[model samples]
Target: MNKAINAELLDLSNCAKEPIRTPGSIQPHGFLLALSDELTVLQASANLGDWAGCSAAAVVGGPLAGVIGEDGVQRIVAQLGPELGSHPFYAGTVGIRSKRHFDVLAHRWDRVTYLEFEPVDRAEAADFRHLYPLIGDFLLKVNEAGSIQMLAQQACEHVRAVTGYGRVVAYQFDPDGHGHVMAESLEAGYHAYMGQHFPATDIPAQARELYLLQHIRLIQNADYHPAALVPALNPLTQQPNDLSFAALRSVSPVHLQYMRNMETLASMSVSLIVKGKLWGLISCHNRDPKPVGFEKRTACEQLGQILALCIESREDARELQFRLEVRRIMVAMLAGLTQGSNFIDNLSSVFPDLLRFARAAGAAIVVDDRILLHGDTPGKEEIAALVDWLARSEHGDLYHTDNLSRAWPPAAAMVRNASGLLALPISRIHKHYLLWFRPEYVHTIEWAGNPREKEAADKALHGAPLQLSPRTSFASWRETIHGSSVRWHAGELELALEFRTALLGIVLERAEQMAELAGELGRANKELEAFSYSVSHDLRAPLRHIVGFSDLLLESAGSEDAVQRQRFLKNIKESARLAGKLVDDLLSFSQMGRAALRPTEVDMNDLVNSCIHKLAPETRGRDIEWDVAPLPVVWADPTFLHLALSNLLANAVKFTGQREMARIRISADDHAQETVFHVDDNGAGFNMDYVHKLFGVFQRLHRMEDFQGTGIGLANVRRIVERHGGRVWADSVLGESASFSFALPKHEDEDEADDGAQADNPTKQ
Candidate 1:
């Protein structure tokens, strides 16, 4: 911020003596009267003789009936009421001075009633009837306009046509509240004030706030004498009446003088409000006294609203077009990146495309200490230093600066060709960035006049606090600007953000893919090692047992008893059968990994019951109790679910053979995201410390004499369940009970189906 702008902001009281709050006067186009509840005149305009045939001094403290007759007073009283709401009420065509017709506007504030009488223009009154069609035509023009600038121009033309002012200018406010004439329509021989800039202080804070509340303001004749109220102070509040909403309320004397200085006889301004903020104004000025009737002014206000809507629509359409262009360019860049080796490697190739897309002079890609440059750029050392500065700032991944030297002074000497910079980081690590740069371009701006001179004149007048005054000269004042390129547009920033997100996604996705490839390779190696180990140990041991038993039988074939030989033969057959079982289990486990999942709604209760029935032979010889609970239907492959459950149930039966009393339980626990099924058995459990190896192929916790089985059941269970995107785990203690559980994602449709099953099978537990 410059020191002059800062000083002007601090010295606001210099213009405070302008007395805007209590002007104690009103425009001469109307006569104002402040009255008590009984119609006693508490205040009257100084020009009361023009309307009431008497001076304001004589009219003060008298009944209004004596001046305008009882009928006129009754008309004013009829509209004033507690039920009238807070807005001003109008009594149409009230007779004043016997021959003149005045539009009577009645409003009450602070327990005091105010009546304003504006002389009606017969010509304007007749034209007001046809205003609807005119406004419709004007709105059609506004909607048909191709751009926001065109729409603003149309609005100025429409307002001028309706109000018949000598000049109508559409002034647009910048982000800093400084205004410039964007469009203008005026009569011949008038000064063309198009493209002139006005300071923010021209419209003080208080005035701007009021403009938001009330959309229109009118000054009928700037040279008219201000009529003071009879009592000067409101009877109830003992303060100036809040005439903020008053149509004929007196304007600040300082503003009136300013108007005279500009040689404008009459003026009116209608606020252009867009999206609930003051976007600009449709300001009208006349060289002669111009009286606009209430009807025409009302029509203009409504037209201003239509113009505001059009302005918003045009701006949105422009933004949409810009975004569409950005999207087209981004799609092309993404396609190019896909063809490259990897995300990081492809970033350099896209730098030129990014530069063109952003209309930048140069671009660079920085990954840690490595830098890739395209077109013109700063030296590597300077660029690295600039990056370090950017990292410490709080702008996050996306930041831009038009005046790079101003932000970082050290860059001024080295970065002559690169005055502006826009940066987007590739990831959250902040180690990589995609940067765009622009060369320094000198610019010469033509201002309407010296802004500082006008500011001084404003502070000097009325002993008021420092404020901006309108400059008298419209001469072109040229100023040369340097050390900056054109500022980045909001749309460009949006494109930069999109670029950042796309690059980030590409980088993360590539990382995930590489990690997945590495994991797959590692798992393949582990599987190969496990297969070789199991074949050498388990298969070899079983074969050796068969061969040894056969040799013993052969040795005793002709010598000993036939019973011994038969026992040896039986041992050989069992060993061979165990080997065959191991091969079949291994095949099944391998197939489970490659099989495609066919997921459907499967009833867990039915699956568990079937598993238990399939193991009926094992359960019959033992004293066992089965505790089953209602289980919800889940989305899974029925075949895989059955296999997984069977392995668990069979393991329970085999492990519990030594127990005097065996017990098994099947139940499911529900959670927000998944459902867990627990299968508990009163069986010989393994040590908890070795649980990590429990799911491995051919991993065993018990000897064959005690368990009487191969050790592939749990491995097959894990493989099948995992292929269905579920996880399996086991918990156990030494020589006690073991609990096995698996969790699967909860599907909404399957869960809803379970509700119907639960209702139908109420005794499922």
Candidate 2:
């Protein structure tokens, strides 16, 4: 706490900006020397006297060759070339003095060179030959590891064995950049630190950058005092030397204090790189001052590399398998959609399989202003509101969020059932989408320490940001999480993307089919119009000619052959009337095709009663017994349904005129998709073989003399019912009861109808 330190701390943001590369001191485990291109020594570590048998005062401003001798300097210089690039160049063993061997590392920055010397133990050197076979076997284990988690666990175990550390942990990074100890191996009597989460700020961005550049870092002892460099500033630039690649370069004072607070005496870290990026770290800690030589550290680095490779391989295989599953599901969905008449109608066939695409608690589909929900979900109105919000938000074709409430605050109350939402927008123009939901998950998260408490303590102690202080307590911290859910993994997102692509293709194909249907319908309509005009004109002309000629002949003959003249006149009148009947039926058939549907709840009982009343005059003389059963209400256009029912009832009345005691019955059969209404008539039924021709235009089974009809009533019935999304069919046998039935959608429960509306309709049902 001096003013300069206080100002730097006050800036809080500049914590990562600290000049760690120019720490002005080196770790006591090694000595550092700064030299110019002319072989002049600009600075040397204060501890150089311990290794060079000289004082810092004498080494300062001295020739580099005179201190370490010309031969050692020459060997380091020979290895320093353009090929070394920006990274540190390892020159293996540089020299041996006073029964000690030293490993040299050289790096250049800003035209100034810095060389670091680490003392190597002879015993560790001798152990290298014996350690190779063990290292090879460990590598084999690393490559053979089954999963990312197992590989990381094995890496920590191997590092602990080779470095003889008390504890080793493998840490992994989440998408949010937070680090968590995934696997660990520790000595007895030590507290377990596995499965503890650390905040992202624990390692600053600058430190992460250094980890990427320098693959391995080690500290012999945190309590060992650092040694200063003589002639501290570079002679050429008058600046501190950048020791980024210095093997014994002093770590940040903040980190040193953190380690001391953690009671860690010595520590080493090797970057676990996957796909050339810093995936995590293999960290080793000891309870005592334990020094690891270069050979053992090298083996740990190699082991880390192998573990990284294993992770990449396993993850690649996992991703491939996930993609295959998505592809398979997509193929199935595509087939279901393309082979059906309507995409919306076919979705049900594959709706359950869609849930298997991801591990979701519930799912929903929205298209053409219609919604289909499965499993747990919010109310229909709430979901509609959510969809509206999604349409207006900056949502891409694929949108996902673990916390739905955070994105749309209204969804906060619905977190109980739908805390997470994964949406694939199938139609941008219409805002149609398929959504997968995840229910709220109350998770108990443990931390290395109370992050909030540590942060407060750091702020009060240093009057700065709290992230610099590493948490010292390793304990369980439990809290009830709310308004959130299990995160959607990267694999799920990729799968969603695949689904969107496939769904888009299906939608486009459906559009093409619809266009073709429209064209075909247009052409058919034009043909029907032409046929109607032609039939009306051509058939009426001949009938008019016969009537005119018969009238003229009757007038000319006066009283001659009165019976024959009457017969001729009767024939002409019959022909004219038949032609007029044909024209009326053709017009009604044409009208049914052109009419629009206005759907409403229609009580079948009232509709049937109305049709019968209208035909009372024709059934006055007949002893007809009406056997009418209770009929359900349906959702359809009332006008179209009235016409369809009228045709069936009239046809029944006409065909059953011959029966002495005519009987007609009306009833309904309810089903899941639609309700079938039957009109049975005890009449002159047709043969079963001619049943197929019953609903065809002008395809009457009975002769016109037997049944006085235009032969187009059933055809009109078919057209009208089909337009209302229903179907009409008939069943009859010769000399038996005949039944004509039509199916329609059950709109809603009869109880749901308003009492006032029911009274006005006055139907039995």
Candidate 3:
């Protein structure tokens, strides 16, 4: 018996010394590489040396799997083979070298009939993201033929770019193990295996079937030498055949021999299919004897899945092509007629193409109250009788037609002039008004066939043979068009539904944004209110104290009691000082909130050094133990940020004075969103329940005697934190120790860019 070897014969005019490049022409990833399954490199990428090392060019046509360092290549192949269990490549990191990593993925993705490649670096957080309605956009564009082929090409280019391999071909397969080249976006003048055919012996029936089921298969290398197969003892037959070769140590020789004949040492193919049939394949060919490992192989598999789903959705398939061509014109006609153009004109334009009338003149009635799509064919008397009958009937229908002249209404006799008539009731769920036309002629012309089939008036409206049988006539089949076709073309209702959802989203988003802006404006207004409160309270406090003292002195003037008056005057002076302090602190706190967040990379050690120097003069007078730890560099607003730290530090110094040797500790820590600084002191603290009250203006936790505070210091700290998109809080124990902490938002590294933000403005989010 002859082998079912499907192959392509070579045909060339002259030795095609790679063609010259046209500037701006689409370039291949590398030098052109083609090989038969024989495992000899036919061509290669221009810069294979980057991955294949210095001796790459010489390694062309060599056994690809044998050329790789055994450890990496062998393990990749093990994972490729069934013996390793179908563990996906993304399961974990397999630290393979760069070349093997790239090759392994390309090989496997194509092997299992999948497209494979590395990501376009998702690690970069600053990468640009598409601003349009991404989900909808992707869904629509992906189904276009040009779009799918472009996607395939992009996957190939990515592999070549990453692995430094040359050309990646978009290969497709037929059921008989024959590969047909579908699309190829190559790197250079180098012609690839595009349009070429590959034989079935290279990929067995079982393997091809597996490719359809799995959607991907990876072959890291072909020349993989496996461990010797272990002989098995059959439990029943006791023959070698009884043993399971499923876990065999080697790939079939027929498979290996096929690859050798093809001259392709290392290759991968991605199988694209739909409804259990082979559709297309994206095959990558590498010139040098290269080996791809497990991790890279996984990347390829993922890429293949992505490409396969894309191809399946593309309009390139025969059925899809037919559907797409028809869908556009019909949907447009529906839309233009139903929604955009004047409904009457659009309906009239659709009439000539869809239906015809030889001897008919009839009015279309839209029962203003009933809401129906009324046509004139059904006699006016018949329609009125039907309507009256419908009004009288409760089953949502009324159906008797032939002897309409005998019916109560004079218009009922008009039915005699009509050879055919139909009547259907439209309701809430089935919304369009009933259509009554000569079903024998109308159904054949407009209903049963595709609009694409329309040609002339004499023929069926769809150019198909007309059938006037009662079974296919209007009188009989009013249910079909009214019940199905007209209902399917329900453009207005569906559009209204989608519009409702999209409108809601837009409205909600706008409302949310407005609320945010309003809040910011409100905060600004509050700052002015706080300023007014401070001005009034501070001046009144001082004036009240002075007035009280003056009254006491005046009273003493008669009694000659100078000592009481003197004490009252001193109280007035102290109160005046406290009032002045309150006004100053209030202004400072308000300023913190109003300030803009100026982000920069701040060296914490240097910032702390400056803060310590400013506080050094005060520290010299007390026996305070100041412990400062090493600080990390952070990104933050400088002035307001420092104000927060200053307030926290001052609180520490003021509260930690009870002991003979006061201890104040300053330190910083890192977090996902911000850098937090803490000022810990052995001071009198407050109860846990009062923590919420601590950050509010004028909400003091302790009296001046226990722990001195204007009640605005912590509020100032909170204002500073929020300005930088961060928050601050504290924890403490009464009379034991207190730790005051504040956080400043960490600055992102300038080198990192947000890809999502196409416009550089941070305020846009």
- Encode model 3's per-residue lDDT on 282-359: one tens digit a residue: 666554445444344445555666666666544323322342233334334444444432333444454432222211
Sort every candidate by lDDT, greatest first: 1, 2, 3
Worst 10 residues of 3 by lDDT: 468-477
2 or 3, which is superior by lDDT? 2
Q: What is the C-alpha lDDT of each candidate?
A: 0.73, 0.73, 0.45
lDDT of candidate 2 over 196-257, digit per residue (tens): 87767667788888898888999989777889878777677788876777788888866765
Q: Candidate 1 at residue 411, lDDT?
A: 67
User: For model 2, which pairs clash?
Assistant: none
| Tens digits of per-residue lDDT for model 1, 437-514 | 998988875555665656555556524535534445445666687898888888788656655644544553454355
Better of 1 and 3 by TM-score: 1
lDDT of 2 at 416: 93
Best by TM-score: 2
Where does model 2 exceed 4 Å of error? 1-14, 55-61, 75-82, 92-101, 121-131, 229-240, 462-467, 520-765
After superposition on all C-alphas, the RMSD of every candidate to the true structure, in Å, is 24.8, 28.8, 30.7
